[model samples]
Target: MNLLQKPILFPLNEKVRLIQYITGENSMLEHIELSIYDIEPGGKVSYHEENFESCVVVLSGKVTVDVLNGKIYSQLGTRTSVFDKVPTHSVYIGKNRFYTITAETKTRILIAASKTDQSLPDNLIKPEDVLIESRGSYHNKRYVQTILSDQDTISDKLLVVEVYTEGGNFSSYPPHKHDQNLLPKESILEETYYHEINPTQGFVFQRVYSDNRLLDQTMSCSNQDVVLVPKGYHPVGVPDGYTSYYLNIMAGPIKVWRFHDDPEHEWIKDRL
Candidate 1:
């Protein structure tokens, strides 16, 4: 199966351009749903999910979100690009709630959802609320921002994060897999990577492989492209002279994230 999904041009319409990547039938993912929205100024998109807890992440530009016709968050984002290295604004709406996003400017956003039985309060995660960290060392260096995690009680089966990698560097390195359900050793989780290149013309390579070689694929991903990791050790590498940014949405039977590195490559961590 081709894991890389390229963007398709949508018909010109007055409403926002919505690309549904993982809406049940179109994707191999069973526990996750992802969509991206491109909205012109004054355009709006409304949605209500009956069984999934959803998160709205403002990728760029500005917007206002209204939840359940009562609570409204105004002017939530201001980044010129996802590469701004600044934290983004995100909203979490629990199951069976209605929400509308109206674009105050030309905007792009991502929605990630997963099944949940819990109904929690809505939360507007401000830029300051996101935890940013510099991970790895030397060539493996990358920036990470946690948007939603198991630590946050708002969502039951969703985890979201944004990562930035410099040219000639690697992210999700040393090859790790979380396809097993072992508690402290590993947990089963399917992931989707929404990639954006700095120059918009550059590309990156991501490799997905398993230990027994049952699944192995290397995908060349461009801007606005998405790569799915159903079950494998997935890692990304950026070419020289271009930067890489990707928004990752993960979900599984269990909410916690535990990964085990490939045994052969596990020695690299000891040297680091």
Candidate 2:
């Protein structure tokens, strides 16, 4: 087995492959798993009992999600592309359930799964139900759409959110970390950022570091790339002229999200 580096980044080429499983034997991931699927019109993908909680987010085009052999099903999606910055659709399926996704058009979907035994319901999150909010001040401002979690829907261990940062803006600002299991202060969570740049050729920069700089690393990322955050304060910067979009998927021992910001930059929040 090959383990991935702390901040693993990889580009995705949709033209050569239909489905790319981002994390595998060569990755350091222990709980969270992710994959990107490029399905053609009328294409289908099936899954049996895998004993994992999963969320299928339609990045573009239309698709019908059939769970438990159509016992639970829904047609979701609308954004022509992720760069459109519009709210899209997603489906959450609980552990040990069979599911199938059928594309009605050329579609790109993100499948994020986490091993769990918690019993939750199979549900659909419509565009309207997605909580969209703008955070930060001036140049640091960015839009965030929460797809699943305690604040919106009920789930066992999966937490999903989509973030859109304008060109030259900062996201996950001030640097925050959820790497400790400190009850009310912070909770240990493993996260991944699936990125998509506006121009399809643009890029972004991300930093992951610990208190003592033991795991510090700054990485340049391009469209259809993924950044894995195992721990530490993570912050992102989008260069001028390119809007950045990333789908965040997180899961850990606790279902709640409690984080601690880098003390040095935490002051920035007071002025916001």
> Which regions of candidate 2 fall more than 4 Å away from where they truly are?
1-16, 70-74
Show the colliding residue pairs in model 2: none
Worst 10 residues of 1 by lDDT: 11-20
User: Roughly what TM-score does model 2 have, to 2 decimal places?
Assistant: 0.91
The CA lDDT of each predicted structure is: 0.89, 0.82
Q: What are the per-residue Cα lDDT tens digits for candidate 1 across 1-272?
A: 77888887473477578664566678788888998988888998888999999999999989999998558999989597898889989999888998999989999989999988888788889999898899888778899999997787768898999999999999999889899999988999999999999899999999999998989999999999999999999999999999999999999998989999989888878866
Clashes of each: 0, 0
Model 1 ranges off by over 4 Å = none
**What is the C-alpha lDDT profile of model 2 across 1-272, one tens digit per residue?**
22122223233343213444755454777778887877777777777647788889999988888887445555689788987888899988888888888888888888888888786788788898888899998779899989986565567888999999999899998899999999799999988888889898788999988899878888888877788888888899999999999999998876879999999999888888
